[model samples]
Target: MKTYETLVAEALTVVPEILPWDLQSRLEQAPAPLLLDVREPEEYAAMHIPGSLHAPRGILEAAAQWGFEETLPELVRARDSEVVVICRSGRRSALAGRTLVEMGFKQVQSLKMGVRGWNDDGGALEDADGNEVDPELADEYFRARVRPEQMGP
Candidate 1:
């Protein structure tokens, strides 16, 4: 029998090191994974992976929003659909992915280094108001708002 991680990794058809650039291609070829930004709303608004859905970790884990049926249709179309959770780093997303799995989401994965890594790798990011933002400006905003050291487990 496959371990959960093994199963998920295979289902997703990619691994963490393959950062943001391959994302567009992945979406084109396979079932587009539901790109979930699990950071705070403010942090997410400042900049995030393009085409991701906003489901902050707090909201996703909170009992109120789990398996929200209203979003199910969109979820289903994203490659038979899988939810890809992301945060500043891999930690929170890993936890979120685990929770989704428990909730019977058969396929889930965490973006290993979060959007921060994506930005560092020259990935395009959009602003809080859903406008295009210069990468440098987004970096500054994220640096100011995302206190990684202060984040809680």
Candidate 2:
């Protein structure tokens, strides 16, 4: 079996990594690529990129098969759509990007540094209700939950 490092290296070769600022700029452009969050439901609920679609890494491959009541986004169901996968710290989403590439997705990328980078770069996150998450609360959560070791230099 391939090691995590091996897998991530392979994914990095094929899937381009986009910084938070780059993604923010892209979103401002017309026809923005789909932002797909591969974090768990609770993580997504706590905070996520505005306009991102949630498909937890565990169920990402089968997301299309899930019922609409489960909140499966239509963009994930479409095979040919351009997608950027994101997780808490970019590791899971790198694997998810590899999965999408293996599944024959033509255009797939992983967000560099994940939501942490986005938050650090002053990007806004939305709550479950689609309201903008308070910056202080977001910072508190990040500091409390994210270890310094987790944030790679």
Candidate 3:
């Protein structure tokens, strides 16, 4: 069976990517890219890129269009705008970006290395409280703590 890495790799072939520093610069320009954080609610509530719209990976398709309960007006309107998809790691965003492309979104890209790399590269992150997360604290949060049982065969 194909692994998660295999899927992400396939998506990466089609999804454009931007590094954290480049993203920071792009954010300063006119018509800043629409940032989409596709992690679960709890993960997003913990911390995310400021002004990012949270549409979990599970509901992305719905959120991208109009008339659905999950529809995000901004996303629907941004079909022609630059959009950046982000996740804890870069993997999910790659797949999500590909989905956006398939759905006819123009100028879609993934945040390479994701929020973890952003924090590592001194990019700012705000908690649910809107307080900037300390780099050290973000580091703690990003540590991979997979239990033995979570490993696949």
Task: Give one digit per residue, the lDDT tens place, for model 2 in 2-85.
Answer: 988888888798888999999989888877888889998999999999888888877777774445544465754556877899
Better of 1 and 3 by lDDT: 3
Question: How much does candidate 2 score in TM-score?
Answer: 0.83
lDDT (Cα, tens digit) per residue for candidate 1, span 103-143? 56666777766776677767778876768778777567657
Q: Each model's TM-score, in the order given?
A: 0.67, 0.83, 0.96
lDDT per model vs. reference = 0.65, 0.84, 0.94
Model 2 ranges with Cα > 4 A deviation: 1-3, 64-73, 144-153
Worst 10 residues of 2 by lDDT: 64-73
lDDT of 1 at 55: 71
* Model 1 misplaced stretches (Cα beyond 4 Å): 1-18, 61-80, 144-153
Please list all clashing residue pairs in model 2, or write none if there are none: none
Kindly indicate the candidate among 2 and 3 with the higher TM-score. 3
| Winner of 1 and 3 under TM-score | 3
